[model samples]
Target: MRDLDETDVEILSLLATDARRPFSEIGERVGLSGPAVSDRVTRLEETGVIEGFTVDVDRTKLRGGVPVMVDVDLAVDAGADSDSEPLEAARERLRDANPVEHVFITAEGDLRFYARVEGRTVREWLSGTFEGVPVDDWTVTLVDEVEWTPSIDGVEFALTCAECSNTVDSEGETARIDGEVYHFCCSSCLSRFRDRYQRLEEGA
Candidate 1:
């Protein structure tokens, strides 16, 4: 991994809080010009420091109550002797599943792959979509609580509201509400923040 400098870390920190925040605003906060901030962000993206910008959607507000994390163990074909070949095949099949949010290949344990599923029920997530797929064993981990912290270069990011300048911390994994970014300490806070932000957006 490439080492990140102080300015790079600060840029990552700010972007994590609100991906949509203009480069000018980020530059103001970090004491750089808009173009300079833009250049840094571009470099980070190219170097893989900033992977991609994504909006965190609220699952509960949609159809599902809460998303479940599923660990799937696949029974590979005996003909496939090499580990890399089997693993790649498993990943390709799993990627076809619509409910699968993320998939990871592991090396240290008996379980070779893990995935996060978002659906109305665990059965629908597993049996309905992944029934015919060859799998030896599977495990489902329902996330009851999550506490997320934004860190860059071994330091936590400082969060502040764009409107109020209130300090905030990662309550959990982020979820998008409409189109704006909001930070919450918990699910309750998330709901409240969404409502307030929506109202503000409407008024403007």
Candidate 2:
């Protein structure tokens, strides 16, 4: 798959706002045609650039609770050659926990994970999970929210406007053609692409 550029970023941003938005509507906003926008979107999904769209369900309504970060300093056995075994085992245990949202390994050699907790399970997970071995220390801190979004900068693209040879910023504006999303610096270039696109369609 090709690298995602500014246009891809913009498309993702638009979708982020409204997942159900029509590709043609997104194209009009970004200066791309419906087919072109649709193609890029498909590419994004195929390449895993766009993981999967999700609905913003109200957690409180579903199951009320507080979100917290669990910081666990894994206790590797003294003189043990590797902690990988214990770490993986612990991760497997956490996987069964429905509250768990994300898990990550920090550079400082600790596991930082986020999960929602309610009633007594919070205390149980905080202690019972790492009781006998493996964890050196652990702490749970309540968090207001958890958001994980990534931005790819200056990602690879076709590089220039098909209309004016102007350099395109994937973040700027866009026009899609034959399923390819084209980025533009402004409306004028996008307009140029739009005009050419209509003619091409009419001719076709």
Candidate 3:
């Protein structure tokens, strides 16, 4: 695995500020050639450092509604063997529901989501949306405005091992199996993953 360097972080910062910035411009700032910058960017994509380029759209201007934030407390299912699956299912349902832009799970196992309410009060929207959902209680806040800024300052990049979920350091290795790249903290993990994958393929 390639260790993330200062140049990579600079390239990421540039891209985060403006995804449309030319590779040549980034190369100039990072003291690398255009092709070198392109190569590094491609490697970053392959290593999952760069997921994808996307635009930050102002949803309020596009939709006819009042933007609001909702915090939902979920009921724990005592009868269920595992609560994670149910929580995930509830989150998916909320995501698929209308006008929800961003969804997050808090450290205390509460759900917070941003949405735009149209033609209805916050109470009505909440009552209608959380009809069959496993919810205990909820609170809503009207959003007046929003400002989002993404930065890479003081960020540390560490890839996780595919087999053991350990952090991949300088001593780690990367493997490309069946056209998909995988990272490992050590050669033993890589070998074990390969063996298990081969066995699964043979069984299939």
Candidate 4:
């Protein structure tokens, strides 16, 4: 993996702020031709340096439910590693849990769970998801205030549709073209991707 130069960083900055920014406009500011900038951005996407482009939407304006946090400590069997059979089974159950947005495991093998409170209380989430699961102990805390889709570290989080450049959901359809996977959130995006791929292959 090659380290990004200043030019790459500048390109990322512009795109992160405005995923819809034209390549020509970016080139004008960054002192590069349209094609040059296009090639660099394509390379960045292909290399996974840039995940995807997204828009910032106010969660309060949305109709989704609030967030809740749950902490679960599973029972550890004697003479077993962290990835023991019981833990793996519990993990599988958690994956199928309703409204579970995120789950993180601590160094002590305890789980930190984040879930959506869609007409259900934090205790309800615990009862629904963690019930019947073998656990040493568990606790629930309602997140009174929180930030959804917070910025990653110091960088902005944005994911643009690779085909049409429209801001799309993180959980979208994906396709593998010539061993390179591309994300598409709609049929229009898939059509655009197919057309572009055909053109590129024909030209090649």
The number of the candidate with the highest TM-score is: 4
Candidate 4, residues 16-130, lDDT tens digits: the string is: 6588999999999778999999999887777766666653332322224456687777777677655466566667676665456567877876678776666446566666666
Tell me the tens digit of each residue's lDDT in model 1 across 108-193.
Answer: 43333333344446666566555665667678777765554668998988665443344565333234455434443333344446
Model 2 lDDT tens row, 49-140: 56666423333322335678888778777788988877887786676554565678877656888776674578776777656657777788
To one decimal, what is the Cα RMSD in angstroms of model 3 from the true structure?
14.2
Candidate 1 regions exceeding 4 Å error are 1-62, 93-99, 109-120, 157-204
Q: What C-alpha RMSD separates each model from the true structure?
A: 17.0, 16.5, 14.2, 14.1
TM-score versus the correct structure, for each prediction:
0.39, 0.42, 0.41, 0.43
The local distance difference test score of each candidate is 0.58, 0.65, 0.69, 0.64
Model 1 clashing-pair count: 2
Which window of 10 residues has the lowest lDDT sum in candidate 1?
A: 55-64
Q: After superposition, how far is residue 169 of candidate 3 from its true place, in Å?
A: 35
In model 1, state the lDDT of residue 9: 56
**Each candidate structure's count of clashing pairs:** 2, 10, 0, 7
Model 1 residue 63 CA deviation in Å: 2.6
lDDT of 1: 0.58
Summing lDDT over every window of 10 consecutive residues in candidate 4, give the lowest-scoring window.
55-64
Stretch of 10 with least lDDT, candidate 2: 55-64
